[model samples]
Target: MYRMYDVVIVGGGPSGATLARLIDQSKSVLIIEKTDEKSISKLCGGLIAPDAQRMLGKFGLFLPKKVLVDPQMFYVESYDLETKNKQRYQRFYLNINRKDFDNWLLKLVDRNVSISRNTKYLSHEYSGDSITIQIEKNGKRDFVESKILVGADGSQSQVRRKTFNDFRYITKYISIQSEIVGGVILPCYEVYFDRGLTDFYGWTIPKNGTNIIGIALQGKDAREKYERYLKNVLGNNFQEVSRRSTVIIRPRRLNDHKTDKDNRVFLIGEAAGFISPSSAEGLSYAFRSAEALAASINSGKNTGKDYRKRSLRIKFNLFMKNIKSIFMYTKFLRNLIFKLGIRKL
Candidate 1:
């Protein structure tokens, strides 16, 4: 059957949910989520700062205090790539459980939102103006037709596969993260880096009784490096990791002055390269980008051109990428970081 919608978002993560909420115009919306139910295990450490909050606040969403482990500080740890100088940098930021935070945001979205979980996107045929997406679930198949298609899916996004040019991005770093059993975590996001970590860092986020610890490493030696890091972190007495997960983040989205190109499709969040370079964060940016898209559509503006070209967001993103590339490209900036530093300047 052909279920028509004004907008059809392929992933029900933060960006998709936020987009559905932001578009105040009454239009049929469908969210196709591949993750089963409310069990989307988040691979992030869940940290937000003033800039992130400021962005989300524009859409009537901001960090809620109930979910915060610590609502006021971000910790950055630096290890001299050459000399092992352990420096910790602290910046005021809000912290929450990624799983909890995303879930909370989803619940706050308008009740008109209809989301189908565990539904995989099979394929989509674009008529050069509109889109028809085929999805399968529970041994049955259905089709969705929409005026606009949004790829809010993460790094391995299927929507990106359909809309992408033949360009392969700098698919950077490999992360191994999990919830820890017993540890005293500070009230901040601690970042640790050194030659052992190469182009990445290890992190420990506090959540009262438990701790969230992980590292981002690269190359074929990543598994060995991660194991070694865990040993060093736990003093070799730690038992098996509780739940290990991985994610591949882009270094920065370089080619686009504006991220999307087609009128029929748009990209937001990680799929759009909206992940912040300094902290590798996305939820707040996702909300911001989603809101930008909704606002453009509401004001009867052209999304593919007008908002893509004239919006302050696109300019800000390009600006952030330019400044952040320094961190992604070399260890030179690593030398300037203290064990504790601030988020801006």
Candidate 2:
């Protein structure tokens, strides 16, 4: 007999794990995670917003002090490479260690929730009111059937590709982050905006003991831009550090849920392109999307329709932010906007 699950969630990030925790315990749910360790390393700034704190509180998931690095009233310093001008703005956010934060969320999941680590979703096929999914583990293949399939597997989700092959997604930006060693500590976050350096933005976020320097751009020469930005920031005293790069996706349409001929499937987190267009923030969106997805299922509604409705506010905000970002492409407008000191985040 084939193994069975009422719901199968691919990817064990904030979205996947939270969805599992919100699911009814009586349901036979399975989470397929690619990482073997709970606290897997990830490339992110790991800043939690004030709104995120309330969201976590609603779920009864309180982040311990250990998971948080430090709380600070952060000032964002924006640099214009074209005119060599700098402007400062303040925004309060809590910095955290991505590894520890993820581990904390993972621990909150009920022990009854079945989690298969070191597992990768291969492919899936619909058959007789169920979907048969193929997964790989330890060089071995296994099969499982699920009534509802969820693709929470990041931007480049294998589950989304295999299940929602026709989902229109645009790869908008490429982000590269490097761990800085023996770097000077700064009291606030820094951002660099230069069309020549990158079309998007370059940021330096202070961590517990070190700093994370990264850049997001819209062209094919991401590595070159990243290196140039690093050199510009560090001058001749720049040192080599470990770096990682990943693609950021943006859905062409947020309200549409046409993924081939399947409606029993759902996509959340980066798989559905819930990232912010301006800030490149996804953690908050991931958590919120997971909550929306879980609530829809528990209420006996169409997951896709419910998710589309639930994400309207987020999509609208992203759309407006993208419009605002257009002004940032031009140096004059960007400088003016910074000079005006608009507090809206």
How high is the lDDT of residue 100 in model 2?
A: 79
Clashing pairs in 1: 75-189, 76-89, 87-339, 88-339, 88-340, 89-339, 89-340, 89-341, 90-341
Q: What local lDDT does model 2 show for residue 232?
A: 79
All candidates' lDDT scores?
Answer: 0.70, 0.77
Give lDDT tens digits, candidate 1, residues 46-109: 7776667777666565566666764456555444535565656555667666677777777777
Rate residue 175 of model 2 by lDDT: 80
Query: On residues 1-345, what C-alpha lDDT tens digit does candidate 2 reach at each position?
Result: 688888999988898999999987888889998886654477777888656777777877767888877545467777887778787766777788888787778778889888998988999888899999999999999999999889888878787777656444464677888888654536678888888876678888877666788888766777787778887786655455678887766544444222212657888877777776667777877888888888777877776677667867767766776786678666778877777876554
| TM per candidate | 0.87, 0.91
Q: Model 2: which residue pairs collide? A: none
List residue ranges in candidate 1 displaced over 4 A. 62-66, 70-77, 165-167, 182-187, 256-258, 310-312, 318-322, 325-329, 337-344
TM-score of candidate 2 against the unseen true structure: 0.91
Regions of model 2 farther than 4 Å from truth? 38-40, 70-73, 166-169, 182-185, 250-261
Error of 1 at 296 (Å): 1.6
Q: Positional deviation of 126 in candidate 2, in angstroms?
A: 0.2
